[model samples]
Target: MTEGTIPAALDRAAEHFAGREALVDGEVRLSYAELARRVRQAARFFEGHERVAICSPNTWHWVVAGLGALYAGATLVPVNTRFTARETIDILERARVSALVITGTFLGTDRLADLGSARPGTVLRIPVEGVEEPISGVTEWDALTGLDSDFVSPAEPDGVSDILFTSGTTGRGKGAMSSHRQALSVAGAWADCGGLTEQDRYLVINPFFHSFGYKAGIVAAVLRGATMLPQRTFDVRETLRLIETEHVTVLPGAPTIHQVLLDAPERANHDLSSLRLAVTGAATVPVALVERMQTELSFDTVLTAYGLTEAVVATMSRPGDDAKLVANYTGRATAGFEVKLGEHDEVLLRGPNVMLGYLDDPDATAKAVDTDGWLHTGDVGVLNERGYLKIVDRIKDMYVCGGFNVYPAEIEQVLSRLDGVAESAVVGVPDQRLGEVGKVFVIPRTGSALSTEDVIAHCEGELANYKIPRFVDFVAELPRNLSGKVLKRVLRKENG
Candidate 1:
């Protein structure tokens, strides 16, 4: 593995794979040397910022801005693109982000303007859909080109590289901080497991904000000098088209993504023979889905992995794992991690790749990562005799919705603020397409008329799309135990 910081890795990539294609985004194509040069230019523009944030979808701009920020010795903060303006602003404020790289207007929303007074001191807007004219206050993505490129980063391998925020059971988001070495360590482990190579063309459909996309997708591709083809959003047709056209060899995302691709009616129309590797997890991976990926999708190797924002790339299935093992187990620990079942069968992980700590929350950090260096992952799992891990349940009331973690407390907190809601409880209900979707049981205030539409509408403004409840059921009261705790198990049984 390459030593030193991420910028050092990029420099190594520039020298080793100078002529090889590094990025392919829409009409843009850049070789390794060209990509490094562009990153240096963007780095010059971001040099002064302490905390830089990227709040855009998966695009060339996102890659450049993120890498550039790291190269400039800034701690990168990735904001979820699906987050509402309010949610985004809250992140920016809490993180104390000084600079922001955001989209101009995407999906009929002017994100730059949406920031309002909470906008960072410096903002660079990427025009995903060509803007008619540059915004008044924001700098255009292209504007960074004129900046001086002869810049040397002050970043160190042990320095904080990024702050990835994960929601807690308390509904508050906790930023998980990782050093440059820790970040690259996990990416290297994942790349090695998938057997990623320079010749591989990676089609990154996962959002760049999550660890799966940023660390495992982009960072892993960079480590191996693999060509990255980032898709802004997941569209089945576009995915198939890219696979056929780009000869995409590496595709890693949620099982839902591959499931949709395999089930797409138009799948046969495209020549998908180029796909060789498929890495999936974050939801239940049926044995049938694993079999179909190899048989129908022509993926030579299909693997399943398990990870969390705190300890990215903890466990992963190897290349030759059988369908049953690949689907049923998240293979043994990698990335120098020691995995064990803690109290109540909680998955406890201790490793070099574990995050340094939750940003500025020592109490929370101490609770998560014990003195013995074990990260108490609030996931219940079982380890087989062969050392394979099978995650059975969550110790915390959190669920994975389409590969993104959705904490019920966050949604419940938002619902508590609604005008007509007296009390509410949210749970994850099984969904065929997304694996799981949120369902909220509400107890309306007396004499207050609250419809399902009202509940959904209230959440739409306050929460992300995935966090919003799919089913809104009005109930007179919630079932509780002798301890006065809401019996979520009872609700799940009744709902089931």
Candidate 2:
């Protein structure tokens, strides 16, 4: 096996920990040897393909399909299972994918059926939970998993391994091409910082399409021989049950997951004593929340990580850092990474984990990463005396209010601390006088009557008048992408 290729790493893990638990999805469990054998078999089935697109929910099959694609020496393109038919078609066309592996149905959505004729080629359907009736003219995923296990393919260390599509918040999403070496760099960084081991049972709540899950969640666990428990969606009860039943030791997700877990009435009923490592991040992580995670959630350490799709595992808070710093600031740069604030406080990064470039789009790639090796992260941040990065907000997410640049993240952080607020997002909208003012959309706590007036009163002393949101709207939930990032573009379209 090639040294830097993913199959090489999997082969090592399988050889060393053949009997160890490797994956758990629903009732099915796979040991390292079994999983690696399946990966090699699936690779043989997919040999001679240049690119393979995978659209599946969080399951053991998803991991197998992804690894199989890599082992086959094909570039893997992971499409969001939640994407619309048009969005799915657009990505396949962009990548010029020769083969496709998709799920049947999940959460009342038939991902494969919905694609319809959009993708009408060699399609392999993974038997997911919802779709009972077998679809016609599609190859079964299980058939491919039973093929020959011994196969080696040629793959350069610098060869592109995966093409991860961006969230497409601003425009049509671009695929960030990542090489085999870059993937290992990201996976290793997460493994070292997370302290992953064979004893750990990692529960990944993030989507498989996102870097947070694909790289940091699964790849990291695979590299360290940790048992993986992937959750399709975040449910307070389900997550607690998984942790209790599986003895989950590592769980990483967005802040919203923790907030719901911390506030669940039945939370006390679950035996979450097995949880020792917790990782969460957002634009603004409340210090109080981190404290509660450590004390209330029984996590040994609560870490906040910062990275983009273009570069995974850039900066992460260390275990012994100050609690306030761990909560609010994205810790020092990872090894082999040079992080600094560029023009206008934009985060500039140069690291081994930086992606190859945006696939087929040289202009976008050039604008994002300059010739001098620095990838221009559009996020605006401050480097404090301790060299920890305090993220203010996305430069694109920032809006001007009354001639003063207002970062919605700062205001949202203050709002998150308010008594009755469950979660909140601030988006800039057209104002008659101020030109652009914040229009805050808030999700009120369960059973609590949190009125717009109450929100206004809470913000009186916490923020400046110009920084305060002029319009307040209450909603059951904020619109978010697969990775749990708030869709401010949708908010602006709804309220602007």
- Model 1 pairs in collision: none
lDDT of 2 by residue, 341-447 (tens): 99899999997778899999899899888999899888889998878988875667767554344667767777888988999988898764445788899898888
> In candidate 2, which residue ranges exceed 4 Å CA deviation?
130-132, 167-170, 398-496
RMSD of 2: 10.6
Q: What is the lDDT of residue 124 in candidate 1?
A: 89
Report, for every candidate in turn, its global Cα lDDT versus the true structure.
Answer: 0.92, 0.83
Model 1 is weakest, by summed lDDT over 10 consecutive residues, at 129-138
1-496: candidate 1 lDDT, tens digit per residue: 2367899899999999999999999899999999999999999999889999999999998999999999999999999999999989988999999999999789888888888878987988888988547556778887888888898888989999999999999999999999999999999999999999999999998899999999998899889999999999999999999999999999999999999999999998999999999999999999999999999999999999999999988999998899999999999999999999999999999978889999889999999999999999999999999899999998888988899899999999898999889999998889999999999999999999999999999999988899989999999999999998998878877876
What are the candidates' C-alpha RMSDs?
A: 1.2, 10.6
Best lDDT among the predictions, by candidate number: 1
